[model samples]
Target: MINDLPIRKIIHVDMDAFYASVAQMDNPDLKGKPIAVGGGGTRGVVSAASYEARKFGVKSAMSGRLAIKLCPELIFVKTDFERYTEISKRIRNIFFDYTELVEPLSLDEAYLDVTENKLGFPSASLIAEEIRQRIFREVGLTASAGISINKFIAKVACDYNKPNGQHTVNPEDVLQFLADLDIRKFYGVGKVTAEKMYLKGIFTGKDLKAKSLDYLEDHFGKSGSYYYHVVRGIHNSEVRPNRIRKSLAAERTFNENLSSEIFMLEKLEHIAEEVSKRLHKNNVSGKTITLKIKYSDFTLQTRSKTLAYFVRDKAIILETAKDLLYQNTLNNSVRLLGISMSNLNTKPQKTEPLKENTVSVQLQFKF
Candidate 1:
């Protein structure tokens, strides 16, 4: 039985269309319109889309050109991370007042452990509402929250209601809440993994739980064990206050596919600078420099070089990235280039961008 597990009150707070909403908040003219934040030029990729834009099938990671095709009146605004960060800090302050056990997943989302909070409130649902209301009053933005017995459930619940809403799953209802969930809705199950589940006759959490642990392990390896337990309402992961940074990265998607290494040097140098600055900002350095290349045909390749000592200098990062880049032969026309440093010297924080993971048509790396 999962009775031994502690029933912690967890809340996942996610700002609705954070980047786009922030844009609309600052500029009244953009409110209630089909506005997109970032992805402005012909080759730009959308970073965020307003609900109006979403209704038109416009979405983040979509090509701006295609987003315009979907919503003819879609407006694209530049991404101002500095402004977003400033506003995010204000939101974090509100979270801190409730509980110091706040784990920021990103600029727009976080997990708060309110099982025992500073306010000593017993109802997480009410606290979530109050937090949402505070965000609106102070930051002029709406936030949706999901409160549950654990982080995974809370994360999934937070997305149940879209903009300006909240959902709660009591401890007793956790099993039913998990059972009724679609296989794809499982937090860690991506598109490929979901497809794998469907092929294996696993269509829902109930179907997933029907299989024996041995059966799952035989098919999905360690992840099989993970799925087996989480479906049974048994995620024991705690809300870690100090989430260590795994890697720091900076990347750029070109308007046109570049085939020459000579043409890539300037771009790589710029990306290295961005990655180095972030490492310094965190007061950490890493020894492993990985160069990520995305081909025009959508295949991915990574080359890594580890040094004897940690380094965070732009020149060092640039040189190392260059070494790894030139180490391999150019396979095809390169559409994107990224620099990432891992094996960090210090235990850093959570939420550094993994820019190389996306292959957007116009996902430019602009601050």
Candidate 2:
């Protein structure tokens, strides 16, 4: 079955400790020091932790308080998104020099289809190596690259060699490589899913392959079919370079929580303006308007309304968000307010360069 699949050169490049690495590169004093990009306040969360800090169990999304407790000597630096965005653009420019078939996963990671590259490089391994070296030389940061036949394997392989390294999984070795991998390491297999797989005596790709498709579906529902084929190295999902923006969103976390509906409405308008600008900038609009509210206690609630026609007007987005805001009772003070537009009605303009300011909220399924 695997032999029937078309072989393609896919590379997943992920920057190492992206935010913290950038901070260290810019400031020579931060090199080799345990640093985190985010506030060290009680309520703040660590956005990224340097490799030095990770040795002490510090990680991204962990609360600053906990991060400090884990590593008292950890240094916290505020996030500099503008700096990161500038660097990301430079790295992307390097990627485009090789292949236009580039799918950016985030500010620091992307999947590049170098099967037919501009440089006419025959070996994806060489391309991946060149990319990493160029990123280090031009961008002053390290990146890990994983080269395989498909996105799933490439993404997983990219992590095999962390920090500044690259790994390649040949077509013939895909099965053995996956079979030797722990089930917990499979894409989309979270902690809970791994535990369930363990309870079912499936701990590795080899173990998962032993179960029948029907059995996996019975055990895991819709996702079982996904797991069934991916375990067998049968993923056929293409690396979509021109993936459409399913949604456009802008969110802001306030310095102070607001209990008043008037203040909340005011903030919603500002957020709506930001979202509107992003929509217009992307030349896309959507029918569904969602309002996300994160209370002072960090509990989140979302309200959405789909209109009959897609609209990109700021007034319409603000009005819809306002209506949703009023419909929900203010159960608690709000700390963050966000507005998003979905059910898009426009396609991306291929000629336009990808904007650094836009945020894609949709999840890209590998298979």
Candidate 3:
């Protein structure tokens, strides 16, 4: 079957409590203590939590305030983006050495396509083990890996085992694993969607597969088509080596066209505001701002400007977008307005603070 099927070997790699582990690795005294990353302050949220802290019900995305309530001994540290990025680059280089098909989900996670690789290994599991060992020996970090024939199953398999563990799901087991899995565990089924599916009596893959495509589309819209593919273990999403963004924009199309300039400016301001918010959240500032306009007759035109410096401020985005809008003629009635930012500036350097650990959290089993 492996020889007959169009099989491709994929591996998912994830760092274990990456930020907290890196901090502990650097400081010996904090070895066994319950530690968290990204929130010592009242308002900050926990970005990562060690297994020890997780035992107390502390998890990522929970507010530091609540995390402390769960475990009073929890230690929190601010995020050091630079250190993490540096480690990420090192890991990425290692992946490229074997193959160029590396798709990073984040700094802490990635999927590597090794079906045709430089190492010429017979099994992907062997390659995964080599990658994990390389990360530990070279980067002073522990990484978990999952080996499978595709991204969907591979990603789920990686989480099966905890820190420094590896798992595999062959082609034969893919369907059975997906069939018995909780609907919540399926990719793209978040908390809200999971609740909705449960309400519809779709608790497992089999439950979901039992429904007709038309029925799913009627209830869940386009997601129904997506679910159809995943439940059958047939995902065609590719591992992009380098994904680049040409433009990032948000737009609104009103059902009715208006001639009032004030209302038009207000709508543009709102779109610009959202674009600015997203830009700052990604820590990217753009030098180019473009405005898109659509007339009631379906005629469209765009105007753009290149700025001297990168900016992601709401006021700046609005001011620039307004200027571009005015530069173009508003001959016909307007139906839609869009704003986009591009030509990103250099990323900010992140510095991790080094702390002296007064308490040592030791692994009872020993390293």
Please provide, for model 3 over 80-123, each residue's C-alpha lDDT reduced to its tens digit, 9 standing for 90 to 100: 88888898899888888788899998899999999888977778
**TM-scores of the candidates in the order shown:** 0.92, 0.90, 0.70
Among residues 3 or more apart in sequence or in different chains, the pairs in candidate 2 whose N, CA or C atoms overlap within 3 Å are: none
For 187-211, candidate 1 gives per-residue lDDT tens digits of 9999999999999999988899899
- Those runs of model 2 whose alpha carbons end farther than 4 Å from true positions after fitting are 1-5, 347-367
Clashing pairs in 1: none
Q: Give the TM-score of candidate 1.
A: 0.92
- Superposed model 1: Cα runs more than 4 Å off: 1-5, 347-367
> lDDT scores for all predictions?
0.88, 0.88, 0.82
Better by TM-score, candidate 3 or 2: 2
Candidate closer to the true structure by lDDT (higher is better), 2 or 3: 2
TM-score of 3: 0.70
Residue-level lDDT for 42 in candidate 1? 77
